[model samples]
Target: MKKAAIFDMDGTLVANSPVHIRAFEIFCARYGVTDWREKLANGFGMGNDDIMRLVMPEEVIREKGLAALADEKEAIYREIYAPDIRPVEGLKELLERLRAAGIPCAVGSSGCKANVDFVLDSCAIRPYFDAAISGDMVSRCKPDPEIYLTAAAALGVSPADCVIFEDARAGFEAARRAGAGRIVALTTTLPREELEREPQADRIIDSFADIDDIGALLA
Candidate 1:
């Protein structure tokens, strides 16, 4: 199997889950949805479309449409997060090492194309990835293997050869379903205990810096 790396953008690429939650709060306030927290009780790893449908009332969705709400909320998130955009610890070095080793990489994010571009461009890491699969491009997002599968296909790599990186339970499940060779989840969004409660990730780390040997993980 050819070796490759696949990454999830939101919490995995940058510790931006807090920023997303804040953006959702702002959007919910604007829409008079005070119960946003409860609405998102399921999980935070889902795509914007799934999030809006889960958090917004039926009437709100009917009035503004799911696409419009997703766009607006993401715009707000970008405005709030762009000023402090940076890659997670050890990201640059990891990418460089992977490149030097000739292992192709791809971004498989459950975020919209705009958000994906925003993060990649803002962090100046767009050139590191050979391919990217965004939420808007897929009919189904995380918890389904479409995004990861598509990214692997774009890179001409087999899922069994890809080391999928993620930060959420849903993302882990998605990676597993995609048949990634290994699933390395970061505890950036959730604690180790919580992540370890389930067997989604083959290994869980606090950050990219925690990995002393990336090659070993893939093997």
Candidate 2:
């Protein structure tokens, strides 16, 4: 059977984690929160609401509300990163090979739908994904496996026949828990050595271009 390749959007595909960090910093500044740098350092792959809750005290979290800040943060992120939004090196070539091989592809991410749309549209990779499962689509985000499971189901493929490409520890764990056919951990946000510590990936690569034969990952 043809296997499916599930991709993570942010650092893995579009290299926008830094943009997100900057946005969070600027957004929090307006609220008189000055520790956004520390928050982002450890919260790169988590959902927006989760990050907000972590950075803000419980009372503050309840008062400020994530939806309001999320909109402003997203706008700041888009304008700041718009000039340089592009796919990771070798990602386009890998996508082309997958298309030629008829391997199904999907994007499963802890990013909101608006963020997903902005990144995919900016990168010009929207058409390549069979489905884009964002955090907004599910009740639980990464480490829950629901997003990856959703992608697998959308592709009409069994979870055991889908290989996930991820860049974060939580996402790697999610792919493992999702029962994917394989997990290829890409270390764009984290160092390759750090990503290797997950014990969930079948292989660790710096980028898709690092793989000699990307199709062999499904084998």
Candidate 1 lDDT, 1-219, residue by residue in tens: 449999999888999988988988999999889888877756677888898888999999999999999999999999999889899998988998889888999999989999889989999999999998998899999989999999999999899999999998789889999999889889888888998886878888888888888668667
lDDT of 2 by residue, 1-219 (tens): 438888988888976677787777787778888866776676666777877776765676677678776667788888898888888888988888888889889999998998889888888888888999999899988878899999999999988998888888778878888998888877778887787677888888887789777547768
lDDT of 2 at 70: 69
Q: How close is candidate 1 to the true structure, as a TM-score?
A: 0.97
TM values, all candidates: 0.97, 0.94
* Alpha carbon lDDT at 22, candidate 1: 91
Per-residue error (Å), model 2, residue 37 = 2.8
Instruction: After the best TM-score superposition of candidate 1, give how far the Cα of residue 186 lies from its true spot, in angstroms.
Output: 0.4
Relative to the true structure, how large is the alpha-carbon lDDT of every model? 0.89, 0.82
